[model samples]
Target chain A: MTDLNRRHVLGLAAAGLASTVFSPLSAFADEKELVIGGSIPLTGVFAFAGVAIEAGISDFVKITNEAGGVAGRKLRLAYEDTAYKVDQSVAVFNKLTTQNDIHLYYGDSTGFAKTINEELNRRGSILMAGASFGSELNNPEKYPFQFMAGPDYVEMIAILLEYIAKQQKGAKIVFVNSDTEFGRDPIEASVKRAKEMGLEVVGQIVTPPTAVDVSTEILKLRRANPDFTIFHGYVLAPLPEFLSQAKQLGLKSRFMGTFWSMDNSLWANVGAPADGYMGVMPYRYYYDTAPDAPILEKIRKLRPTYQATGYMQGFLTAMLMTEAAKRTLDAGKDLTAKNLKAALNTIKDFDTGGIIGVPISIPGNSVPVGRIYSYSAADKQMKPASDWISLKK
Target chain B: MRIATAKETYIADEGLLTTRTQRAWMIVLALVLVLAPFVLNAYWLYLACLVAINVASATGLNILTGYTGLVSLGQAAFMAVGAYAVAFLDGHLGTPFLLNIFAAGLVAAAVGVLVGVPSLRVKGLYLAIATIAASFILHFVFTNWVSVTGGMSGVNVAPARLFGIELASPFALYFVIVPITALMVLAAANLFRTRIGRAFIAIRDRDISAEVLGIPLLQYKLMSFALSSFYAGVAGGMWAYFFRVVTPESFPFATSIFFLAAVIVGGLGTILGPILGAAFMTLVPELLKYVVEWLGPVFPNAGAALSPVRTIVFGALIIFFLVFEPQGLAEIVRRIRRFFHLWPFKT
Candidate 1:
């Protein structure tokens, strides 16, 4: 303390801090290139899906640029990792939107999209597309510039319940979902819809999507002993835990799930118990053909690997945004968020090849369409349990 | 260049801002805070508001961990209590914004006392584990109490109204948040001047010795918990107003760790530590993003690598700070202050 030169240390510290002062001022937009930015959950609970989603958007941009840039302006996509935290997402949101003046923004989750809703409105300059399918996001009236690529959580629930009703009337059922916004997204509405369809819901269990041991939850479900159980708000862990335990306990009920849990990878985890498990998914699995699964084909050609629903959602979000942007320029309107959103509304009979069945159009910022598929232990694949279901209402 | 002699009275010497220099610095800082909103753009304003909310919460943690030496990892859970309290009451009663903040603090303080019950017997790592259990239980409640807590879908908080204007934007929230945070920080600093504050320090230094001195360990410990939780509650309420959404994910276990890290890195047992720590932790990610952005031209897949790199850098920085500058950023400030004050003197 006595011998060291304090002035030099202070000067060094000041110099170190000086670099930081200029950092917040970084990434001023390039006037010539069109910009799109996003916050992805690169390192947190959703990292597995986040990586795939990031690839989807980036690949689309790459392939599009190869063909020729959109509207003669090369599209530049910039993104930051949120680590699946809302605060970080909001920080990234502000930094990207304000500093880069990005024309379109992508978000990682339902919570982020909902939290940043007000800021998006106030800025009124960028269009927001997210990986979430929350029903709240379906309201174009409130969030005019916000859009999702698939059916809203509510619509997916309705579609599943309608399929369940078709299978057997007066069926006894159990509702099991993760205790997350994604899990709880369709419960109340599904309950009401079930009652309307004359299906008896025997039990409803809400556990964490990541819960590894669900014996207690299984015991609760066993008390109800319903004929069927539907799951929501999960991808891998808790679903397998719940399903495998239910199998060990010799529960005769058929298991089902929504889009998130319908991954092809999930079967490997649940193993033999996955034989009769069925669920709803908006996009066809990797094996589907004819309409050119453009994104999936590209992913396979380069990496030679399997794909999942997250990739589809990410690809379609970027696709729709690009389509909307293209339509704006095609109509000779300025390439602004306002014009892009308006042009997006008029997307009619858009043949998405075979990725999501043909002749698809966004109605109310959602696709509002899905199909029911059941896992076959013998064939090791998802067989169509029900035809394509559309809930225009 | 000597400007003053030693103080004759204890009161003058013990005041929160003891010297004329500190008072002047305070004035300058306040002026900057009030003026920053008008000058900073939307992004910086948003960042500033988030930092203020975090600082408010971090100050509370500093009281418990730094000063009192109880390592409770439920800061974010307490914040959830405060946040949900404000969200529910504001929706049902339509209470004034300030009142909601107070009520939020009180509710969080109540939960804090419950969480503190286990700390009576457990200390060190056990106490931390106990608090982690408490956090999980509270998370379960926040998610399952669907009728009241809105389950996992999370209930939305209506925009706060102040003088017939909505405090919806980050810029609009600055006025409501920054002043409250400042007052809370000042109040925390002032608490150390009282008997309660000394009792906390005594208990932290040696609970047995403090009990021998008739400090009433359990009562003071619980009181510290309540006080710390109250600060967290208020900050969470401000968070709700700023973010305009309340969900379980908003205040996860990671957030509690984030606050504890801030207190540790800012300089434990110092009033200025939490402030510095919270700001540094919050801004580091942004700075990392900028670092990655600088590399954008060099790397095509840098976007995919940004998150892992940020995480690595964050972990590395924390380790570096703990190993090398264990006294924290506050100590560095102290060194600078000492150097400036004793300049050109041969003491």
Candidate 2:
């Protein structure tokens, strides 16, 4: 009986100690502190995008801290590297939401966003903003917590197909993609979109994700002699190599890619060969003298060479989070995940301060349609191709 | 009578004891195993579950490499096969999770027989190379085959369920996995005592001599492969069900290396060695993570530095164990226990 009593006392002591440790920053505290989690690709295949997403969150935190923080308490941003691996990201997300008291999560990749959306919704985490422009993130009914900031890669492919049908006369389009999710996702959407747009998909080739020496595939492309070739790939290094090889092989194919393949680093890797290469971008480059905007200034401060793709992505996501937080505070709601999501839904016609040179807005459970921009190495800028084309419902 | 028999069996073995102190330690392990989930935080429970799965995998590898003297670098491929099989069956048939896991292992055992056919002709490094090739080829097929294997996009494994109860919760899931793993290990311990087990040891020691002794060396070696692959497959299925997702990247070439390293560092050719090795390898990282978290405030850039430092330290520990004590941590434990039991006894 004495031993039982002693064990009970010990258990109560442990519980008492836990309450003391957890109570200080508890949601029950007077001014609640919101915890935002980022499961980002800090290393691996898509490290570039991962680094950009994190910088964006850090800037958002800095801006919030400067502006008296969220509801007078600083927002705590906790990030874990997912390395662009899905299981690792899921594990990180589980840790953040289930174990730690984080309510908001920001994922880096399309796969990360899609995999964890259901889990986040089930757990009542409100806001999940990721740089992944996959259509899977846009469904309000399926994934309410997920709010994609920019145009998805599918929309970009559709826009690219539209341009190819109109601008390049008699151009037969051939899709060369890696044999992975990133490669296959756009292919499924674009094939249907291409049929709708009346562009001929001359050929389609699926290569390995880490494929080197694609001489065989390039030779196959040469035989197809398609004027427009869209290379849907993940790695930055290999796409340039593919381009250089294609040019040397005299394929005479005009190459473009999804957002990942559109970076200036491609041009730096293979200068003149990558001249006519173009891919769709959600926004203009940071150095573009497009218009007066606050985001441009922020971008410049973040990087000297504001032309880097990372700076632009970082600036855009940060702007979205900042706007969401401010609106939440204005609503007189605590900076909770639920309140933040409600604030995001209420946002409309907010400017990204000229960083994107395009006004950012969200209306009726959808990101405002993003305009397609094409990269030009001669001018070293991404000029607006056309106005924002609304995706068919 | 069983205890007496067990004591009598061990009495013939030198430098080993069946003392009261040893029995108490076993009882302590039993208590820890039962009470672990209650005391451990969710993070620890998750880590422990992973450790258990790794132990299961390492134990299987021990049967092939440790017991049968076959070095394999294709354990991950077998794991992938098992994972995909379970994933496919569960998605298609909605079979009970336990049945699906066993089915997956059985399917992998069939594949292991096919791979082991070549092992009859080859020996030593040649055998290792053949298995390593199997790992690479399987990894490639998993990555490229989109329709069946889900390609590189990966496959989502539905949460394991028994009857109507969801094993989605880590605690509930841990209970399910722990018992199954225990059963597998118990089965493995029983394996080494049988005629089939002795045939494996005989083949491992000298195939020609075993053949001369009228043991079907080919049949026994292939059976080792089948058993080893079956264990790996079951472990893989467990991993998939536990994580609720399986990607091609999840079972990589490096994972095969990890399994071999665990067995070598755990104590090859012994029953308890693989579990001991897996626990050490798996827990070391978790321990390092805890230490890093505790020391984060005091150390500059501790958060970023900790992961790389932990990885380096882990690698170093593996190398240290290999160089100094090739027999593994199991030997050290046995020694410590022996010293305590033999205290003040001159002989």
Candidate 3:
């Protein structure tokens, strides 16, 4: 406003941008707190999923504190929005991993994980998790410091293909997904597996996640006449519109999607058109109380606004990270990434109280299991259509 | 009110730092750029590095869009070319980072000429649309051209090595990035003093008049594009060194808008416009984060609302400047200087 104010703004611009690097060791000299940083896409196209994931993590932290914290130290998570951009996430990741001295971190996308992989390995002191269930970050050999909460997208696609193979012998399938690192992650394998299983891979529709018009995609599907259409790489909008449009056109393709597209809110929005929409979902739903998942009870109690599968993944991500931390400390080692990672690798058949399907394990940075679920128009829910499928030998 | 000192020679009058005050400011700015990495923490340094990179890219856009009157929406693509060039060279040849930076500019300049081909036939909004198409095509290339660009997974380069010292951290990168950016900005400012540069301004002011006066439109336009993309490429090379990774999404369409906004908000066609504009554009959202943090206690949902609110505020500020201060921050700064020079006399 004023010249002096302008000068002040310039000063702040030079000195105060991000303010991301803080020597956590210097701040928490008492060693009574364990800090974690996350770069979630809390305010972009993935805002809904981001917020839901935040709710899950927040509730998990709350429950951890209520249960007297991890290793008698308070667990805290500080995350910034990446807006699903790799650059923003990498910037945030650099800040958080470096001066923050955070024991753990969460990132936004597969791209961020890939970008930060070398840095994370070099640091090797901070464990990482986040939104992606794809990329080389899942390979512990590639990046030991990072891990996905579930099986990678390619594995999920394989599981879906396996399901389809069992359901029908010679089905024609078209893979429809958002054109992104996440969406395209499993496409190659999806096609190959379909061919390997003697299924006809008709056509692949790579549309933008925010595509409003499905007329072109519908026309393609109409031409190909696939018996099954599996969608991936989108959580919120495009699938619903496409599915509804396909139904309107009397296209008889059964729709399928991965975790992102397999959301209740997505199906709820699609309504009757999503009656038999299937998903290769990795985690149990927020309302899947038949299994009496304790994580759900904890989330329902702490964060009332939490819903959808992302929250469950978020909850699982936090719980898994903190559990490792708790185990590392209980193992009577210093609260370090090395110790926690050893604990993380040692995890096998560890119970999540069935809140997220059967007991899961992180053999090599990814939990290699997922379940297929179908949405019911009448019930307004996604019920498991197949039992748990695991990639682990 | 003021005394004008006549220059005895053309060189004295046409000098880059003609005034003692300008020389002093340059020294001070140099001191700040040099001393910044040591005093500031990594976060500030990281931001400073980003500002330097963005300022370089914005300066390139300013050359075309501001001085040449050619609106380009493909600056980010040009930058990507530069970045990937650096990444490819650094990854494969292990060439010296300095050579890589120049090669980046040269490669981007070649691509710039190709993209600027449309400028021969188009101008204004049509030109902008053509550039947008160019950018989309470039992005498509970055995505599907898996071998060179590393496909959708993106390419990673080791930390730039110079004398066995890796420019890995922001602290390490500051020394490399800042001087390069400063020199590039200097080269850009120096260009306006030359024939090609004057021709660019002529084309910008009125192309038909400039053509009648014997300036070739296509040649100068392509030169402007080449120069601008060269700057973008060098900046991109610096960015690759700073970030150490290059993805198709790294230089998204939003980035082109960011540079354009910087040139406009900094004062299009002016020397200091891109610098101030890039800094302002880069820092505003960060300042907004401070505002959101301050409001966190009162508004629980502030985190969820931060993005939209920041977007609104950013748009509002841009609109406010467009409506009220069309000449942008540079003009305001000039006015402030004039007011100070007048001191008590105006009152």
Judged by TM-score, which candidate is best?
A: 3
Rank by DockQ, highest first: 1, 3, 2
Estimate TM-scores for all models: 0.90, 0.86, 0.94
lDDT, residue A247, candidate 3: 86
Please give the TM-score that candidate 1 achieves against the real structure. 0.90
True contacts kept of each: 0.70, 0.09, 0.33
Q: Given the true complex, what DockQ would model 2 score? A: 0.19
lDDT of 2: 0.73
Q: Candidate 3 docking: what grade? A: acceptable
Number of the predicted model whose DockQ against the real structure is largest: 1
Global Cα RMSD, each model? 3.6, 6.2, 2.8
lDDT of 3 by residue, B1-347 (tens): 23354678998999998766668888998998898787776556778899999999999999999999999989899999999999999888888989999999999999999999999999999999999999999999999999899987789888888898977778888898888888888988899999989999999999999999999988899999999999999999888887778988789898898899899999999988999999888867656766776678899757666766876887898899889989988998888767765767892
Pairs that collide, model 3: B146-B151
What TM value does the first chain of each candidate achieve? 0.90, 0.82, 0.90
As for DockQ, the candidate ahead, 1 or 2, is 1
Write the residue-wise lDDT of candidate 1 on B185-226 in tens digits: 999999999999999999999999999999998899999999
lDDT of 1 by residue, A1-393 (tens): 666685688676667656654455645666667777889888888787788888778877887888788888677777888888888888888877766758788998888998888777776777889888898788988778899888888888888888988988998889988777788888888898899889998889988667888999999989999888998888767777777888889988888888878878768555787888888889888766534556456656755677767777777788888888889888888767678898888898886646677567876688888999999888778888888898867
The runs of at least 3 residues in candidate 3 whose Cα sits more than 4 Å from the true structure, single-residue gaps closed, are A1-30, A94-99, B1-6, B305-307
